[model samples]
Target: MEKSWNNRAWFMVLPVLVLVAFSAVVPLMTVVNYSVQDTFGNNEFFWAGTEWFEELLASDRFWEAMGRNLVFSLVILAIEVPLGIFIALNMPRKGIGVSVCLVLMALPLLVPWNVVGTIWQVFGRVDIGLLGHTLEAIGIDYNYVSDPIDAWITVVLMDVWHWTSLVVLLCYAGLVSIPDAYYQAARIDGASRWAVFRYIQLPKMNRVLLIAVLLRFMDSFMIYTEPFVVTGGGPGNSTTFLSIDLVKMAVGQFDLGPAAAMSLVYFLIILLLSWVFYTVMTNRGVER
Candidate 1:
């Protein structure tokens, strides 16, 4: 006799499916529609084919923003990954200190993206911000508003501060999952700290490390709100990554067809790169 199956569970997910259709699928279809068509108001639209995509691809501004996005993501991963690993390695494996460290780390992740931007915006101000004023008081000329380097620095630092904790938490989770038997064997074998990390910790944490890298890469590549609120993609568009540039085209400039095309390209780039990252890492895991 066959037992019963809970096909009713499908009903539980129907609401979520409907909500996703309305929120994500509908908007995506609208964007796709806009991408292949042109309009000049009054609900009039004309077939534009791949014209907008060709124009966007030819634009130097788009390429420049893409370059910036790539650079930023690379820099963020370079800094955050090692730093998070270091922090996790050093964190107490047991005690009340563990809880304290976790809470402190989690606090940054809890702040809203917009709020993080605002905090940094004020913090980096030359006149009213502590950092700016401190730098000036120390006789260093610091101004995020006027200097491209300063703007980039402020944005990078803000992102590092906010997101490094997430990496730390992930790495910490990976670290804790490591069995004590491995450490005992290493200790019995007289393995150095470096050896332990290179052999035991790094290998064990590889999966979570991949996850951390992927998350940080995507977040950094797609970063907009913090930089937008802080710099408005300014100091002469020096900090304008793809998202900011896309917004300028779609909303500021109101070029829907081109913007829609750009958006699709952006989505594809992200999806492709993320797939590559996942494949490479998981394959390495399999090999090891």
Candidate 2:
């Protein structure tokens, strides 16, 4: 039997489509316009035809910033994913403790990005902040403002503290959805703790883990606010990731043509990398 198609459903989606076109597509088109053209004051644009792109691709600064971004994302995923899973695995499956644990895990995520950066910025100060003063009292020199290595450590640690809870919550949700029968069956078969986690728990959490990875990757790659507020891409540009560099080019230097070109390339790189991650994970799942 043939089912009748509901053509009227298109009407329901039209408003959303229109909104997206206005909000995203139009602005993207404006960027595209800026990327290929040169403009001076008085709104006059001249054809540059890939000149900006050529310059950006050849620049050492662009490549260095991109490298930093890649390293940061990789480090974030490495630390957050395993830590989140470990924390989730130990959390109470039920009872009053469950709510308490969940709330504590969620607190960091509720803070605004700028506020988190501010908190860390003040917290890491060597003068009066507890962490800084304590480290100084212990005879360890710590300052994010002057030392490049210290600046990097502070930024990385700040990110971990702020975002790891997201991974924990996602993993916890995945774990809670597993039926008790799985655990009961594993026990009946005398499965060891390692066996249960390796065969049952890990497999069940695979989908959420994938989501967590992609989200963390994209967020870390495009990170701006927190690091900007903390380091302002300083300490000899040691922590200036691509996003910061792009902002510097666009807003600080007012180099629209080059900045637009960089932004498009940045967007493409993110899209390609994310696609690769998705493909690899899905294929591995299929194989298993």
Compare the candidates by TM-score and give the number of the best one: 1
TM-score of each: 0.92, 0.91
lDDT (0 to 1) per candidate? 0.94, 0.93
Clashing pairs in 1: none
Candidate 1 lowest-lDDT run of ten: 203-212
Quick one: best lDDT, which candidate? 1
On residues 70-132, what C-alpha lDDT tens digit does candidate 2 reach at each position? 999998889889999999999999999999999999999999999999999999999988888
As a whole number from 0 to 100, the lDDT of residue 259 in candidate 2 is 94
| Regions of model 2 farther than 4 Å from truth | 1-14, 281-288
